[model samples]
Each structure stands twice: as C-alpha cells, then as structure tokens.
Target: MSDERDPSPYDALLLLSFGGPEGPDDVVPFLANVTRGRGIPEERLKEVGQHYFLFGGVSPINEQNRALLAALRADFAEHGLDLPVFWGNRNWAPYLTDTLRDMTLAGHRRIAVLTTSAYASYSGCRQYRENLADALAALAAEGLEPPRVDKLRHYFNDPGFVGPMADGVLTALEELDPRVRDGAHLAFTTHSIPTAAADTSGPVAGHGDGGAYVRQHLDVARLIVDAVREETGIEHPWRLVYQSRSGAPHIPWLEPDICDHLEELHDQGAPAAVMVPIGFVSDHMEVLYDLDTEATAKAAELGLPVRRSATVGADPRFATAVRELLLERAATERGSAVERCALGALGASYDLCPVGCCPARTPRPAAAGADTPL
Candidate 1:
C-alpha cells in the first residue's frame, strides 16, 4: 500500500450533474443549453418542452443533488476522509466552469469528479468529459490556473448501488396486492440511445451486440433478480428494457420502451410488473415524467398494475460506496494495489477512460481519459 492512507493526492470532490430548470422561466434556457449546437428554434423548443410545465416547470434533480451533497459531506466527515466536496452542473445554476473557478481560487489544485450518471456512453461519459474540458478552457481564458481533474469510473455494478435497487424491487413487490406480487415481472429500465451509440459504449465495442451499455445493464438486472430469488424463494421473470428516448424517430433508438413493454405484459396476461430504473442514479425528470407520469398512465389505461422501483438517490449506503471508490482510486493513483469493489459479471471499470472509450459523433476535447485533449 502507499505510505499515505486517506485523501492524499486529491484535494476536493466535485459532484457534477446534468442540471434542470428550477422553474418555468428557466426551462427554455436550460433546454437551449442542452441543445446548444442543434440550432433549434425557441418556439419549437418551447413546444417540445411543454411536458415540463405539467410538473410546475420544475425538475427534482437539482434538489436531489443538493440532498446527495449533504449525504456525501456527512459520510466523509463521519469517516474522517477530510475531503471537501463541491457541486456543479453542466447546464444550469452552479455551472461547471464557475465551480471549477471557485475551486481553483480556493487553492484546491487537484479534484476528483463524480457524476449522477453511472454508465458508459457518449452522452453519459464522453460528453461529461468534454464539458469538463470546456469548463477548464473557460477558466484558463479567465486567467485562472486550471485544477487537475479526474472523473470516477462507472459504479453500476457496485454492491452499494445494486443492493439498494434490489431492496427497492423487493419493497415494490411487497407493495403489490400480494396476489399479484409473486407473479409480477421485473422490467429493468434505462435511457435509450441510438443504436450506433450503444454499439460504441465503454471499452472495445463493449464486447459485441448491444455493447457495454446493454451488457452492463443485463449483468445488473440478473444480479438483482438473483438476489430477489434468494430472499423470496421465487425466481421473478425479468427483462432489460429501454426508456426516455429522444431525437428523431427515424434514428432508431433502443426499443420496447417501458410503456410499450407494459402493454405487451398486459396483453400476454402478465399480472403486474415493476419498473426498475437501474439506469439512473436519482428520480429525475425522466423517472418522474416518463415512468411515473407517462408509463403509469399507460399501465392504468391497460389495467396493468405497476410500481416503479427506487433509484439510488441519497441512499446512505451509496454515500459509503462513493467514499470507498475515492479511497480505492486514491490508492491506485499512488501505484498501490487496492481492492476495487463491484458486483456481477463485468467486474470493475477502468479508473481512467481509455482512448476512444465512448466517442462523441463530432469529436471534441474531453478531459479525464487517455485521449483527453486537456
């Protein structure tokens, strides 16, 4: 092991996320930031963003991240990790560039970033790295020295993550009418990307077929299903499904969306189903509008009872998992062999993203990887 133990090379942890508007007025601008290069017109964007108004034009992600920040700070202090944690978003208030400037001004030279996203894809991984690089470039233009930044690896298969989700499945099953509980199917849901993006996610074509994105989700779904069987003595039938697809319908994204799958289950005489969002870290807009609002509405229409399982949002065990990841990465950075904690078939992901790990359609400077332009 290294001569040092905790928080040695790292001076701070940055909780980076995709931000959402806090109110009606912020919605259009937030969407504009998200679709910056698409050249979408304001009126057209407003028409597309009409669904956000249904929830008072607010998103729960910013608030959820606030709670998670508190949990991380509390956990780190309790464990005596002594690492200062900061929060920032890519598209809204507390923006990434501003946060990095603040950190550098505060004399923090080294920072480790953790994102709300837990998987590998262009949008999930490489895009965030590109955002980091852009923010650092902005800081440099502002005459501030850029802090060295590294992003944490994918944690989809971490026990702390999968365990809570497994419990969520069990709890949702218990909430069902008990008559339908035993027969209820488990549908693991994740965000749908274009087929090309899925094919290129993670390392080395992510090992064929649906690539690392689908492969990783499958591994997690199987692990959760196995855990449920071990506890309840019933092997719940399950399948990995996709959700929250955007972009042109002609592009062909991941199929059998959660709503459509619900319809299929109903027609097939399936008693009930649980929507497990293993793809997301928190119950963000996608979980709320897509699953809770839209999919639930679809299920109600089909008379099929369904409950959405919980995301890992602000779970204490998840906070502990973040702590463990920090220590593990710290040791690895020190050239010390450390036990990397993960569950299921994929094992641990790389600490630093490899070259061409998850390439964006149009190339851009992305920090925190072998091919980082930083």
Candidate 2:
C-alpha cells in the first residue's frame, strides 16, 4: 500500500531517542545514566565523558533530533497529515515520562513511536520497550491515563532511507583524489555488541528464529552497497564492520574495527576508501570519535586517502521515510499482515509486536521512576 492511501491512525508521533548532555555540568550525570548498570567507576566515566566535554559537553544528537522533529512536523503538515510530533529521550530533560504526560494531558491516545536506532539488539529494540513499560507504570501511579503506543517498524530498507545513503557514497567518491577514487574500497561501519547478544536478537520466526543483530546490519549493508552500485555504476568493494565496542576484553564483540580495516585496505594497495556509517542516523559520538577522529587519523598515518559519508541527519528524504512508515503502520489493521522490506533478497511481512515480543533487559530501578513510552 502507498503512504497516501491512508493517513495515520495515531494521534501523535513521538521522536524517541537516547538523550545527550547539553552542557559541561550535564555530561557526567548523563554518562552515569547511560552506564548505570555497567559498574563503571565514576572517575573513569568522567574521563570517558571527556568526549562530550571536547565539544563543550554538548552532543549533536539532541539538536539533530530536534531538527528531525521539525522536519517531520513540516512534512506532516505539507502532506496534510494531522499527526502531532513529540520528542522524548531515555535520559535528560524532556524525559519520556514527562513527554508522555504532556501528550496524555493533551488528550492524545494511540501514539506511534519512532526510535532513533535502526537495527535490532538488546539496546536498540528490547530495552526501549522496557522503557515504555516503565513509563506506563509511572503514569498508573500518577492516576493519569496512559496512552497506548505502537512503534513503527524499522525503516532501514525504505527507499527514502537508502536513497540518501547512496547519494552520500557518491558524494564521498567525488571528494576523493582521482587515483584513490578509482580504486576506493567501501567500508560500512556500525556499533559493535557482544557476539552472543547479536545472535539472539529479533523475534522467533518460521526459519527457527529472527534475524540476529549482525545479520540485520549485513542486510542493510548489502542493500546500500547494491543501491550505490546501481546509482553510480561502480561496483566498489565493500565490507560490513563494527565499531564502538565497550565490552570487556574477555567478551567477544564484532570484529575488525574501522581502523584495522583501513590498515588492511592500505596494505592491499587500495589508494582510498569511503567509510559509510550506514548503521547510525547521524554523526553521533561513535561516528565522531571512531570515524571522523580515530579512523581518519589512522588513514592519515597509513598514507591512505579516506573520506566518510554523512549520515541521514535532518535529510528531507529520511524525514519523508519516517512519515511513510508511520502511515503504513497505522493503516494496517491490528493482527493483519503488513509487507516491509528487510536487508536480503527475500522480503518479509510482520504484524505489530506481540505483547512480550521484545522484552526489556535490566529491571528499571524503582528510584528511576516510571514513565510513559512517548
């Protein structure tokens, strides 16, 4: 079905995301919330939080998300859809509970949520659901009606999403030195998690189980690669890689970090390469540190030319894709099949998540308080 066939059944759309600190004073506490269960020392967290401090303790993610919210609102208005857009973060001001409370008070029910993460994993999928549950419980205590929120399916495969990425890759290719551009290898990078966690992601299906996190990323990478080839008529070599692995050394995470991959490309006599952060929505901390800072430095040391493609931050096409996904989800009746593209040759259809499909990992602390899933 097309997006124009039906407008959203949802009363409002929530821009859900991982919030970042806006100032030096907010950095340590925000980092603390993110690493709450990890048992990382406060001093160490403070040191690590220096990445945010480098940029005046501010993260570009929140601002980027705000711009996205505006774009979404504009798109909805332009298309004559009445869905109101709201913003909430897992941590920080405009907390999920508060935002949901505002929406509830405003008489919005049956909301639709769009999480910032594009892939499936404990952090990306289940954890957010758990947060939603926590929010509902909090609203119950406050004697306020909690709105039912249905999250839109992941949009990693939408033409609106992949098309912008194709443009980015082509732009990067154009920026490279002519010699390097002709022989450039493409390296697509994303967040790394414990291999075991990656293996158990998504819902169980007829194939025995759902696609794992790594598999999902590979699927998106393949689509983007193919799209790039089709668009530019250049079959540049590419590989899906992992970055931002914070797990202990004993635990295995995804392999061959971007820096390592750049070295290998250099050794292989590749003059240049384009690093596409297909796994992220914007140049978040991982993209900033791993690709722009660290990977670029490594490439410079190796004497290999490298350019990084931009993420779909505030891109009009991406905003339109989000709108289309919302309309798609809302138009389909509950328990009915909805067709959606995945990363592979075989497309799949999914119903809305069952009640307990994606369960939350850690039990939310009582002191953290309950919140509505905005």
Root-mean-square deviation of every model: 1.5, 3.9
CA lDDT, every model vs. true structure: 0.91, 0.78
User: How well is each residue in 1-374 modelled by candidate 2, as lDDT tens digits?
Assistant: 34563554678888889988999999999989888878888899899987788788888888888899999989888888877899999987778989999999999978888889877676886677677777878998999978887777766667777778878988999999886786789899988877666665665441113345666667777887787788778788889887888878999787888889998998889879899998899877778888888899999999999999989988998888888787777767343455654446535424354332333454442211123223
lDDT of 2 at 334: 42
Model 2 spans > 4 angstroms off: 1-8, 205-211, 334-351, 354-374
lDDT tens readout by residue for model 1, 1-374: 23333876899999999999999999999999999989899998899678788888899999999999999999998877888999999999999999999999999998999998999888999999999999999998988889999899899999989999999999999999988999999999999999888888888745457788888899999999999999999999998899988879789788888888998999999999999999999999999989999999999999999999999999999999998888888778878888788898889999889887877878888989988655
CA-RMSD of model 1: 1.5
Kindly give the stretch of ten consecutive residues in candidate 1 with the minimal lDDT sum.
1-10
- For model 2, what is the error of residue 135's alpha carbon versus the real structure, in angstroms, after optimal superposition? 1.0
Cα TM-score per model: 0.98, 0.90
